[model samples]
Target: MKQMREKRQPADGRRKSILSQLKEAADPIKGNDLAEEMQVSRQIIVQDISLLKAEGQPIIATSQGYLLLKKAQSHTITRIVACNHTVSQTADELTRIVNCGVTVLNVTVEHPLYGEITRSLMIRNQSDVRKFVKNLEKTGASLLSSLTDGVHLHELEADTAENLELAVQALKQAGYLL
Candidate 1:
């Protein structure tokens, strides 16, 4: 009873530290790096993240690492656009959107069995786009869009409605928009 309470103290403290570290980070922090800093296994860090999420923390896992969702600015505009294209066009599609001064928030797809699946991208520029495309090729992993015949939706964010409109128009011109 008392022993169990004492044992949980350290873990609770570690979770608090993890939350603080995430909040302070300007970019997503990799679990491996967090594990090394905390002197714990990566699995332990994963478990901590799960616990934090279960507590209603706004933490998201991205291709690069884990990120804490920030509140959208009052002037920010977001739009979800449907797109269909081959896997090879992913880079081009993302590049076009970012080139229009929009951030690619995430990709969503509807699976027959899973219903709706979404993954955070948090891609803000060409560099992020390059890293995302490179990771896919390096891992030989299939894009979520592959499940639904290259059909997917992207949530895009920009500073103004015009920026969002421009991004959508770009996708439409590239024949990527559905």
Candidate 2:
């Protein structure tokens, strides 16, 4: 396994170093810095990041570089739920959560390598969802539904069970949550 991976030329010595640098970084770290420290090409660092993310590492690439999300805590108060609906239903579902006074934190979809790839979206209102949907249309990027066949998970937050339950019921009644 190691030999096969070596052909991919992942920064073996640099993996740990990059990880260490990432640990101390409050924000994303640049690919070049990661490459220089590892004594490898920046392209190699990119590939290494791909490998790490594939292995279930919570790394996010921003314009600056890569930011490793702090893993979800076991005692998180928010609830993660899977819902299936048409692409057209995305906005209403998101708006429902916001209207019910909950913060829609993240959305997750399965990636071939990275298992569940989650994107943080701190959406809080109908306008936010509208803006998001507009951006999706603007980018010409397909929704996660295109990948998960209309199934997606939402990490939603509220102060109490009643609030969360209200949002869930609202989604179910709207034919969003199945």
Residue 158 lDDT, candidate 2, scale 0-100: 80
For model 1, the local distance difference test gives: 0.93
Per-residue CA lDDT of model 2 for 11-95, tens digit only, reads: 5656766776777887568799776665567998888888888888777775335778776665445888888888777888898
Candidate 1 at 160: error in angstroms?
0.4
Model 1 residue 126 distance off true place after TM-score fit, in angstroms: 1.2
Model 2, TM vs. native:
0.57
lDDT of 2: 0.77
| lDDT by candidate, in order shown | 0.93, 0.77
User: Which candidate leads the pack in TM-score?
Assistant: 1
TM-score of candidate 1 on Cα atoms, chains taken together:
0.92
Query: How many clashes in candidate 1?
Result: 0
TM-score to native of every candidate shown: 0.92, 0.57
lDDT of 1 by residue, 15-105 (tens): 9999999999988899999887777779999999999999999999999999999887899989999999999999999999999999999
By lDDT, who's the top model here? 1
